[model samples]
Target: MPEPPDPADPHQPIPHSAPWWRHAVIYQVYPRSFADADGDGIGDLPGVTSRLPYLADLGVDAVWLSPFYVSPMADAGYDVADYRDVDPLFGTLADADELIARAHELGIRVLVDLVPNHTSDEHAWFREALAAGPGSRERARYVFRDGSGPDGSEPPNNWKSVFGGLAWTRVQEADGSPGQWYLHLFDDKQPDLDWRNPEVVEEFHDVLRFWLDRGVDGFRVDVAHSLVKAEGLPDWTVRTGMLGDQGEDGTEDAGEPATTDPRTKELGPMWDQEEVHEIYRGWRRVLEEYNPSGDPDQDRILCAEAWLPSQERTMRYVRPDEMHQAFNFQFLEMSWRAEDVREVVDTSLRAADEVGAPTTWVLSNHDVVRHASRLGLPVGSPRPNGIGAGSEQPNPVLGLRRARAATTLMMALPGSAYVYNGEELGLPDHTALPDRLRQDPAFHRTAGVELGRDGCRVPLPWVADEPSYGFGPGPRSWLPQPLLYGPLAADRQEGVSSSTLELYRTLLRLRREHDLGVGGLHWEGGWGPDVLAFRNAREDGRPVTVVANLGEDLLDLPEGLEVLVASGRLEDGRLPQDTTVWLA
Candidate 1:
């Protein structure tokens, strides 16, 4: 492991002044899609361990593994059945320990996803709760309510599930008598727990302690903002299509009020209750307590996936006493506009400042379209279009240029940056999968309007030509591998100077060697209508300027800044289209 930088140099500035996460680049691994070790066509913990060296070589400080716990495979393991043990499909508990050990051996931290809001209905606890009588402690652990009202109607409220339709599901009473309704925020199989219950809190805390004790480093809290809900379960006035609708409201012709919905505004404070801070605070206390004792320098991190839009709501998960950081989804929604990027960056910084906590940004994840695809290139266009539509040639060089520029922008920002697996390789989005092969629920829910996230969650391509792309020696992977990935394999680009792999290495090394921190951001010069320019200076006075051209034309360089790193070769400080440059 690399030694922590010095802290006592007034003139030199403290090395490693940034928290473990501040300068750290996190790589997200969707476990089921990463690599299949057992060749049962499913990726497992041991498969991940086999790829530790590959991750270490990518220059990430930590690997954020999506949920790998035991599950019925619903929601891709997000519906966890066992928090304390690994699923038989992934591996045994020993495999998890070994994966962690291998990651630490490479100076990489392991952060696992913790889905606390709900659990698989098949979970032992939930099953036991269903088997027990009413008022049972196990039943109290989840949201269970009697349907016997003045007239035996539906659920008490009209709250909609995130997966569409009602959030309530009917399950048999403890004694196998009749059925009763229970609340679930997602699939019917996932029943939301009653956070108001004291025992529920203690049980979740114990779950955290169990993992922390087993050598897990931290957690990426799933649906972190959904922990609390309105106790009254009041009827949400039918005004809009649904509460969590991302695009057009689906309630247009339903004879409901389409112009304004009284329930829309009230949803936030009610679902994302202010009391959530207390819940996170409690979890943070458990994390701090269970962290390794001997290493005072080691810091435990808790990152939350907050879906709320406003800064005030987003900051609730990141207050000093709560989670260490919350994901800023602004960049994920960014279009091909420099102004939009600037606004997102500024808004996130201001929000983080307000809460006195660090900020985090992610370009892509398992849920969204890859940046290359989102950037308006033709579906699967290998290289960025230089100027005209016909110039759709594979420019591996330009691809790396874009990757480097994106990295430069992310690293030079005020807080931590998350890079999805295979992003460093400039992997393009998959767009040709047949409908039968699609795995994302979005397709079914959206009625095929959206292509679903399965395009981004395909198996990682490690080799150019080998079957399964070196994910394993299997005839086929858990998910189909994109044909375009073959030419961009790790083996093909390992030592190449211009490879995307090398650019990532160089950028990560620069971030580490410079000891950059949150205090390093210093913006200067008015941003062009289509260009983003900013300078980041370490406390020690080492300044690096990042300039990105989000427009079609080449951008004129700012006077007096020397080019340090260019996404592509630069002539007289002028950047080519779709280019990025790092200047000293």
Candidate 2:
């Protein structure tokens, strides 16, 4: 192992002395869609182990597995029934151990998703809470309250679940009769835990320690911001859709409007509360205590999934006393405009500086529309009014260009960069999933009024031309693979020149060799109308400038910069259309 680069000057970035994840390029693997090992039409731990070499070859230092814990598959694996064991649908305990060992042998760290916000109603804990009478100790582990107002109507508040309804549900008591209501932030089967309960906090801490003891590298905490809720239980004044209910204020409406609810401005001050920091500090302390060097101050890795739009708010989740990094969602929300990208980068850097923490970048994730689909040129016959129909074939060249440009921009950014599975291959979002085939709870519950996440969660194509495109050896797959992906499998692109996979490999290799993976990024100019430009300087004094053309036209480079990487060819210091360039 190499010594870590100086904390002051990360650009001279050296690999971390212990695990690579401190500055690693993490690749997210949606296990159920990664690779199926048992011919069971679903991916498992053994399948992940078998693909370790493939990930290693892609130059990623770590892989983050989305929730593989035991669940009833209600909210896909987010509704965890047992935090310590693997879902039988995915694999067994032995398989997970084998995966850890194999990933380590290949020099890849493994991070599992830790969803502490809620648990499946079927979980023993939830079941126990149901069995315990109201006001019992066990029942306090979750939010439990009496029925609605004196009029016998509505919930305690107007909070709506992310999956599209009231956040509360009625649970049957152990006596086989109607019981009190419980809180759920998503599906009715997944009830939110009361973090205020010391026992719940201590028990979850134990769960965290269990995986660390098992040699897992770190965690991608799901809904880290939602760990705690406002204690007052005030009725939401804003009413929108079904979340609006009559309140005690005399009138039926008492909460802020619906738009304000998603932002949860009222909850911001309490979002990352002192108690939350204490909880994170405790978890960090545990990780440090278990450090192989036996030192308690050593650094470990913990990434958080914070979907807030405010950069200042997002930074709160990443500090010495909090998480190591929180996902910067600005890039995911950015348009194709270069100005938009530049503003996002600059804002993110400022945010990180304010919190004395590092920043992270992500282009796409399970929740967003695929970049290719979002950027592809639209095509169709002209309508009667001379406007073209909404049907269009993707511009393959432009798609590849956007993919490469995004990759270069992400790699050149400071802190860690996460690459979603299938992103490197320029996988476009699938539009063929019918309403009957859609499995996303959000889409199913909203009846397609809300966009489904199924497009991005489709199965990966491993072997071109194979049944289900090698996602499985059989005809069935958890999610259907597009025919287009059949010609873009890993085996098909392996060793092929000019393939999208090759571009990813080359970019990642450059990132590793130049220590570009860790550094301090600074923007040197105002937002260009169609270009994003910035410089990354390591403590070692190596500075690289990155310029991306978000427009369809050519772009001229600043003087004295030599191109080191480009999404398209550079001609006399000017970028070609739809191109990205790295300069030294």
Candidate 3:
């Protein structure tokens, strides 16, 4: 028989979390789908403000709002027309200020989304760039290059947009002639800015001060890794994934392989470059003004939306004077195998330990498939952008079970974690959304070959029986809702003890009390290969072991192990398959 597990802290007193970002749980709120007020069939700042109480009750430390900036909605607010003002579609600038104020009142910090990689084609700067001739000062702020082919008919080189087609979009000259081609890593409506230009560098500093001067706490830097490029704009040597579009503010993980080999990867001319660290170091200075540990409530933070070749490369973004936190895309990509989970966790913690930064873990985000659904698929299935329509359907029941187990496993680790919006309800992707209502540019640009991220961005359901499931007072939601949403609405699960929402609340509360987020984790291998068992021990000697069962066979816990919580109900004295249990 396996040796009995170490004693866990069953009755240890829990304490409050540290300063908002230093060691806390952050929740991602995709503002467009979180809630809709004013009955416009779209979510707004006021709707988010109204839901602050819900977030606080759920026990998250801070809320990261996706872009609500002024935009023409070409790429769903990402094609920003104005960085300093809130678009009327979401609310006014005054509403944004009020939302920040309201969030602070509830002891919840707010981090607004900031898109620095590109601006909407309608932005004043882009307009000026268009009006000016090539080689002019205005055009210098953007990546406008001379075409190589005769009469400049061909693009400058061969670079693809993240949405689709060539990355370069030809423009009409001042004299009404087809002229220079400007680069846009994403949709044609959003042109990539030239960070080498001093004006561009100074402008972002001003934008940073603009939000910091306001009551807002910090920013989730969109496309954090793509701001700078190579010295000579070299051609690609290592190409990964589909062709045509390769830009989504540069967050694509390069479709890395699943092998555990110790090898280095070349991310090419435009990704995870060494020069990006200098830019973040500058942002760190701005963040320092508000990061006084004495006032933990008002601290500031910077979250990098980086998808590097490895978690080790991702850690350089958080090297003390760089960013406070960087998303662990490697962790998010790990398969559901016990050894894969252990490898990513060990590598992540070891990487962060060297940099003296807290290891941050997240399961899902707006641009990716929902973890609940993703987990149900075979461990090594290709997750190319979004699951193309009718490719592979997930087992909803299996997915939810794995998702819950994964969350428990993530939370029990030793660092901060992020919970994507609607994750608490165990919401799966609306895989069957009608093609007509699909709004993601990834879908239309690729002509249905690439389904894009719309399946995960459907408007959330707030009430079971209300119109639009209480998403708004409107008759219908902006995106179609699945029929099962009525059964999983917040109103239906609010007070139910067995609901996923309640499980999240209880887990967070217990996580705080157990001091699990600030410690070191050690794996226990005696329980066999299908089970992942680890101990998170604090300085007080109270170790909490979170064990997740990944196989069909039931795993039995040793006697006298007091169960603090579980992802699913226990079977006799054994932990059910696809379940996680926290024991002392």
The model with the greatest lDDT is 3
Q: What TM-score against the true fold does each predicted structure earn?
A: 0.87, 0.87, 0.93
* Sliding window of 10 residues with minimal summed lDDT for model 1: 380-389
Supply candidate 1's per-residue lDDT for 89. Answer: 88
65-125, model 3: which lDDT tens digit per residue? Answer: 9999889998889999999999998999988898889988898888888898899999999
Candidate order by decreasing lDDT: 3, 2, 1
Clashes of each: 0, 11, 4
Candidate 1 is scored at a TM of 0.87
**Runs off by more than 4 Å, candidate 3:** 1-19, 237-264, 291-297
lDDT of 1 at 56: 83
> Distance from true position, residue 441, model 3, in Å?
1.0
lDDT of each: 0.71, 0.73, 0.81
Better of 1 and 3 by lDDT: 3
Which candidate wins on TM-score?
3
lDDT for 531 (candidate 3): 85
lDDT of 1 by residue, 7-113 (tens): 21111222345567755689999888788898877778898999889888777889999999989876889888989889998999999999998899999999999
Q: 1 or 3, which is superior by TM-score?
A: 3
Local lDDT at 484 for model 1 = 77
Q: Estimate candidate 3's alpha-carbon lDDT, on a 0 to 1 scale.
A: 0.81
